[model samples]
Target: MVRRARPVLSSLGPVTLDRTGVEPLHRQLYRALRQAVIEGRLRPGERLPPTRALADEWGLSRNTVVTAYDTLLAEGYITGKVGAGSFVASALPDAPPQGGPGRGDARRGVGLSRRGVALAAVGGDMRDPSGRPFALGTPDLNAFPFAVWAQLLARSWRVAGRGLAVDPDPLGHPPLRAAIAGYLRAVRAVRCEADQVVIVSGAQQGLSLVAQLLLDPGDSVWVENPGWPGNRAALLGAGARLVPVPLDHEGIDVEEGVRRGGDARLALVTPSHQFPLGVTMSLRRRLQLLDWAAARDAWIVEDDYDSEFRYAGPPLAALQGLDGAGRVLYVGSFSKALFPALRLGYVVVPPDLVGAVRAARRHFDGGTSIVPQAALHRFMADGHFAAHLRAMRALYADKRAGFLRTLDRCFAGLGRAEAGEAGLHALVHLPEDRPDRTLSALAKRVGLTVPALSDYYTASERRAAGEEPVGNGLMLGFAAHEAEALDRAARELADLAAAMA
Candidate 1:
């Protein structure tokens, strides 16, 4: 019986390169390394020397070693892990196949592209959280005038008959575009025409399209440090190198963004009501961001995700309203205003970018469904959208007040609430001794859905860069719940905190 080869501890014996040979150094190194692996001299699971160390020891350039290592990694002869350096493939080609179902396991031997791996790492819990206590980003579906919406949808289907089945314009349904354009101009103060509005499935899809259209691989992008995690996956999948800019009372710290990635090709922000934290960008900061974008010849994606639910003075004009240089791509969604299943949103691009965005949209799902577009257009054109917003604003205002009162009564010393003037949710900053994740798990046990604020922020990345971490807190959502539900949930959470103490 033949014996299996033993794995080497380190070093690939003594690899010699013929400097005078016609073969390129990287290719020669790759060949020699491949032959060693094939002959079992560098057996499976053996660690490869660091490229820099290998280069120094072998008298070769670091790039040559990297290229050789990369070739081995790409061909599956070796594996590279983040922070863990390269290692020889554990399942070498010569290994006997495992038996039965174990050999056919879907999790085994599944090789993903770099982008796929990145997307895989971006974890999200997409289960419907409607009616769940403290659920984030969900609207009060019970308050929606569904009878009216259903009527509008039925009318849309009847009017759009055969047309609804046909391929839609990549830009959008023309009338829906016109409706969205008018609504934005009147409400958000955004300056745009119907021709500039491109319909998408949702805000996430809008950001994804923006990333694909505006960003190239390795391009620097300024993202809010404790920003929306949903956008991170999209931006990263598009190959953007994210520069997490810190936030202040004025919103995204423009000066800090400049310091971190002054030459960033794009900036993604939630200027209206910053998510998770809900700090409105001051006018001065908004101007600074616009100026920076314009000066750098960069683009800004303004995500007005849930600004319509503001319980304060007057509604803040969108950042896009302040842009004169045509640098801002305004993205809005109906999910927060209407419902998640609607899956509809729109982007108002600069005139110059309209064609490109449309082209990109054509290839990305062939534009949103025409029937929903028509229904939403009817809903908005007939003033139902305005009425709905007004009702939701009042309902959410009361809910927020009651929830704050409950938090004050129940969680006096345990947590402090940042009751921002806007947003459907509030951030309750937990004491340093009480980590948000521990509290979050406790809340989960009692059927509450509060999430840790640190999950939204790249805490590890910030720590690695020697920056102060964003504060620990729980994001308690109130919009979707009745006041009684929110109050009960908050009291239960406070009980857990008290017990924890």
Candidate 2:
């Protein structure tokens, strides 16, 4: 047998070893050394002390130190050579400076651009509350045909040829676009051809695309006061100045929008069932908005989200249907109808504006994934989409009725439901003296997320528009949760409110 030469081991810098419960000694050593590398305690290319020396110093087994060093080596925190021991990586991954002078300032967003800062200012602490009781803008996932969707998804790949293998259309899958156009025309009465329907990731993306493609910096755009906060972010990020137009029993106050920004470049409205308030836009206002866009050489963006769940008769005709001037760009999402994770929505643009929107969307994300687009087309083509909507409409109608009854029983004389004839949520207006914001926070502590109505408004906008804010109320969603769960949550919420009151 050949005689083996023992490799020389060099001494490393001193480090404290943690022998705390549950955590392995090797992992403890790994964390300390990795932190040292990250914090520049161990400078780049500095050789680490030999594992045996560290093991001996810290009363740890030699194997523990070796394992720790091995982990560091794997994570690129250190490098090892046959005889040279380990050295700190010459080039390390970016990590925030920690526990040193000026470290706090470095992480305080001091270097953000003006737009970045502006975007940050407009941001809210909005968290995903899917499957949570009374969570808005989400559908009943338990009722969705997920198994059917899975089958369709599998079929999209299994039975398909090169169509599924290649990149999707910059606009969308042609069949899906045509299907959307046909569906919109038949159901929502939106006027468009297959070419005019562009599939976007979601309605929010469609709004952002419209903002970037149409409006210029400082261009005034009409936005509803207490409207969707997301619309504000998208438009503001695109450098458009927002003119907050108030809403009434009718949809967006058309005359008021013109007063605020008559020459506005665009008007974004949730006309079909105005979000939160859930009011359907009067036909007169729809006509007035369309005429305003026509006369002022402007455009209108109609967000028709969640219209399919209308509790009354067939959902009202889309505001886009009345736009004879082809001035309306209709945005709708399937998140409320199907599920949020699908991330599927469509924009029906004017026939003339189709090319520009498609070009802009091409650069935004090339296009939404072809797999879902193809699957959705098949879903629509086979009539499953309509059938699902029918079932959900009936189910939600029952839930809506049960929810209203529960609210009446729980919040009698204390609050009244102000939601319109349709949509997933009820706007319960509390006595003005009962602060909804305080109540909303209190509800959150108990695992509830009832949104305060006042949080939706821009106070200055409400003041400037000479309109009183929607005032102390909570938007309680009823679609995602079953009637029993919603009733329980509503009763719990009422108890909390009564205690505070």
Q: Please list the C-alpha lDDT of all candidates, in the order they appear.
A: 0.81, 0.79
Off by over 4 Å in 2: 1-108, 123-127, 461-467
Model 1: clashing residue pairs?
Answer: none
Best by lDDT: 1
Query: With candidate 2 superimposed using the best TM-score fit, by how many Å does residue 319's alpha carbon deviate from the native?
Result: 1.2
The number of clashing residue pairs in model 1 is 0
Candidate 2 global lDDT: 0.79
lDDT (Cα, 0-100) at 446 in candidate 1 = 54
Provide the global lDDT of candidate 1 against the true structure.
0.81
lDDT of 1 by residue, 1-501 (tens): 322222222445655666776657888788778768866888888888889887876677999999888666644577766788988877553222211123333553356566656565554542236467888878889889899999998999987778888998998899999999988898889999999999999998999998998899989999998888789889988998889898999999999999989999999999888887888899999999999999999999999988888888878899999999999999999998999889999899999998888788777778888888999999999999999899889888988888888888888988898678888888888887787766775565456777878767764645746666767888888888777777778888888777756
lDDT of 1 at 227: 81
Which pairs, if any, clash in model 2? 12-49
Error of 2 at 470 (Å): 3.9
